[model samples]
Target: MAAVIFLVAAAAGGGSAVWFGAQGWGKAANQSPPVLPPATAEVTRQTLTATSEYDGELGYGVATTTTNRLTGTITGLPDVGDVIKRGQSLYSVDGDPVILLYGELPAYRTLKEGDEGPDVEQLERNLEELGYDGFTVDDEFTWRTAAAVEEWQDDLGLAETGTVELGRVAFLPESRRIDGLEVELGAAATPGQPVLSHTSTAKAVTVQLEPSDLADVKTGAEVEVELPDGKRVPAKITELSTEVQAGSGQQEEASTVVIAVAELSGDKAIEAAAGYDQAAVDLIVTTGERKDVLTVPVTALLALAEGGYGLEVVAGGTTSYVKVDTGLFADGRVEVSGAGIDEGTVVGIPE
Candidate 1:
């Protein structure tokens, strides 16, 4: 098949310059001598990846604040950076420990034998994991459930009330590393006050992006993290969240930022980030990719006198224009395809 050639006149400034139009080619009277471009490059078939790097921080991802649901004198507090797990004491209030339980529901009310809800089921699951048994883990709390709770309370050296009081247990999604202490030891622990802050124990990199950059970012996408020491490691996007950042001045406007959390996998990735408790890193996310496709330098593409784009193909001692469709543009190269474009084909680079 013959390739369609769209001939257009070169602009007055130079032989490589061409006029842009909405419909058809320019008249032959507008043509100029030396129609070929001064510089030429050969089309090659290769994989092209369009990626963007953003500033990120390597740490334990995001921190969440734990508030006090019980009122008492703060007897004990965990040190900063302490890793607290399930069945462990998060903090002490009035000589009683606030046990840590793994669950998504927050402790809202006093759970007694007659109580029945998802919160009850959550508590029962934790209790079972802590070695308490002889009761079914269900939403309903019965006498059998109270027996197990009593046993747990006894093990924790608490009063065998058989009823879980509000604030007796703190529920978190997983084990957490204590980030900071909001209250000091011996301080008064008031209800609804922040007691401590913590984050997941796993290593992660967090990157903030503007709204416009979020179009290609999705969960489970693979990315690369460049550590402070110049070492690169692989990571995957596990979570995405939105945060509102306050402006510095009264006249400034608050902006909504998307926070991407990428979890580090394997021993190498974990060990590479272990040295830095919190440090700046670079997150390289691939936005687009083209595999085994013919590509040319972006400069080779000409804004044709017709509506679309064209490339001046140089073959033997002659040159001609070939209409081409452009794809992923990355690293100064663009994916191009047309009837006459192929691997090793020489294309003119417009001046």
Candidate 2:
């Protein structure tokens, strides 16, 4: 079998490119070159990744406000980006350390020996990990629990009272990166006043998608993020949710948007985002993909006279058309296969 060739061409046939069939190629082989600007594309092998970009922002994830639980003057505070770890002062009120403790329980009442609940268990757990001994970590606040609390209090140069005062500490999980100071230093620290805010130190991107786009943005789905400086980084969707956003009034429409968080994986995106605490990034969410397929310029497909589509192969100034089976169409290209088509086949694109 001699090498077959095609001259692809199309400008108005169903708005798609047409190919000179093998018979047509044979006819054009001995003829003069067609009077048209030469425009052609090779039969290239590539994976067509169907992706869509959405507006996104880079930061340390969602921010939640930390409130002051004591009545005093705010004396000291940590700056934004400061990591308040376990057993450290989140903020000082009247010179007393409002310590950071790890727990899920919200400090409601003063935890003393007589108290018996999840808050006690939470305190005991933190104490157990912070080198306090001789106490069982459970919901019951026994004397041993009070002993541990007093030891911790004494270590912090506070009163060695057996009770853990509600304002003496703030409960958080592990550690947090201070995001903002909600209340200024020297301000009166009133109960329930927003003292500061914080978020996890990890870098992440958040995207809000229209309801129609939610299907492709699933939790755990892998994605790519383009930073403000044009750096691309691979990321994974760590969270996804659909919630109704309340409208201004009862007459207004309550819109539902898909909220997703994508965790960035490399230092490139991070470095590009330096000095930007919260900045916009573009998200390329791959919605569909096909690998190792024979593809050509979507315009290369000719709505053939014989029916279906074809591509024109050009060889030695001769052009012929070969009918092709078309598949996925994306990015101005279409997946194609046929009897005499392979990668490297130069197909013409009609101007």
The best candidate in terms of lDDT: 1
lDDT of 2 by residue, 1-351 (tens): 011112223322332333324334334457764433168889999998788899998998777788888998999999988998898999999888899899877788888887888888888988998999998888999988888888998999888998988878788766899998988889999998998999877788888888888778887888998887777888889877778999999899988988888888778656666667788989899988889999999987766544577766776676666678998888999999987689898887865
Cα misplacement distance, residue 172 of candidate 2 (Å): 2.9
Candidate 2 ranges with C-alpha deviation above 4 Å: 1-37, 108-110, 114-121, 138-140, 241-252, 267-269, 275-278, 303-310, 313-325, 329-331
Give the alpha-carbon lDDT of every model.
0.85, 0.80
Judge candidate 2 at residue 180 and give its lDDT: 88
Clashing pairs in 1: none
Per-candidate TM-scores read 0.86, 0.76
True lDDT of residue 253, candidate 2: 96
The sequence of per-residue lDDT tens digits that candidate 1 reaches over residues 205-235 is: 9899887888888899989999999999999
Assess the local accuracy of residue 147 in candidate 2 as a C-alpha lDDT between 0 and 100: 87
